[model samples]
Target: MATADGEAPRPEERQIEPLHLPTPEEIRGQDIWNNCAVRSVASGVMGGGLGFFMGMFLGALDNPIMQEEMTTKQQLIFQAKQMGRRSISSAKAFGIMGLIFSAAECVVEKTRAKHDTTNTVVAGCVTGGAISAKGGPKAACVGCAGFAAFSVAIEKFLDRHS
Candidate 1:
């Protein structure tokens, strides 16, 4: 359509809309997220199982003689402390393990796909620290898994919609 002057519309007067397209990098991002979801679930299960085993093993380490010789309150205190220690140790161990696992995954991604590994490592560390501080090893595992799943879901959703 032309204006009263019968001239084509100027470029400045025309609206320019930007088109969105998926780049190669975005495809890689989607793949990373898909992998992350699976890995997180696996890591959580393993960590939780290991923590349960460790807790059981630690609980069984009480000395029979020591138990028999202790006063009632002393025994109670000892038991409480032992339980507390187990939780603390389990959480710390799992957290550290989570970090290691993430690091390994990041390295693998870098080597195999030459993808951006930054997000994986950062997410792993955050998940590990959170689980360690709040839920112990079992909690850490669960948290990591959840975090991974959510992260992947969000990324995929954004990719598809955008």
Candidate 2:
């Protein structure tokens, strides 16, 4: 409608319709796959960084007596090399683990039944155990239990809030 000044009313002056967003269930397959890939990469980077720092801290703590015997410059150089080696190894392990775990979860969510807490827990346990199998049966079992517990806690938190 035109105002007294003979100019049309601004668009904001008109009524606006609300937008209907797609629900999670309604998301397309390609979009879901893309999301999963992106999430996996992000998880890998975060896990790698965490592992690197942890390795550095633990490495430093492991050899205090030896560190004290060395000259300051020598100790610093040795520790740097040690930390670098440990951090790189840890970063590789964590990055691979995160990538596998996230990808597995995404696959289970997309291919199996509808996404739910149960599916998430199962996926986490499976991936965790599989990844930890390199250590030993005991480690695998522990990893499975840990991941399951973590997933359950996260699910519960989300449920409570949402």
Candidate 3:
């Protein structure tokens, strides 16, 4: 159809569908912080459990030697246990850092999934690398990486869907 001035009619006149983009009012109404916190905590629990299992496995490797030596062997076993505890502690640190980053991002973005995903993953990697350098690289790499990934994944999944 043509207008009275002979120009083609505007397309908007023929359209009635509403766009779905939320306005500032809607954005402000969403509670992103609470959701992220919940997600972060859930992930932390899972990560912590996995870390505990891994620590147990590492400690188990010293079992035969530990039982065989009642004197020097016992000391070695004690040292091994101490090392395992340290590794678990590092994993816990990484997990906590991931949770903090995810929660803060959620509070800032209010359901913006991308922000939290990026922050958590990057933070995890950095924490893992740092722990590796400080402790044995292999132990830190496995524990920190595993825990960080698990917790971050939890945070990302929940934030994206919710």
Best by TM-score: 2
Global Cα lDDT for candidate 3: 0.63
Q: Which pairs of residues clash in candidate 3, taking residues 3 or more apart in a chain or in different chains?
A: none
Residue 102 accuracy (lDDT) in model 3 = 48
In model 3, which runs have C-alpha deviations exceeding 4 angstroms? 1-34, 63-68, 71-91, 104-162
After the best TM-score superposition of candidate 3, give how far the Cα of residue 9 lies from its true spot, in angstroms. 44
Residues 93-155 of candidate 1 have per-residue lDDT tens digits of 764565455555555565577454345544654555464557577777767766666655655
* Backbone clash tally (model 3): 0
Winner by lDDT: 2
12 in model 3: Cα distance from truth in Å?
A: 35
> What overall lDDT goes with each candidate model?
0.63, 0.79, 0.63
Better of 2 and 3 by lDDT: 2
Q: Where is model 1 more than 4 Å wrong at Cα? A: 1-32, 35-53, 114-162
RMSD of 2: 6.9
lDDT of 3 by residue, 16-116 (tens): 77879988877765644257667678666766766666666666555445455577767776767766785587468646654655455555455444544
In lDDT terms, how accurate is model 2?
0.79
How many pairs of residues collide in model 2? Answer: 0
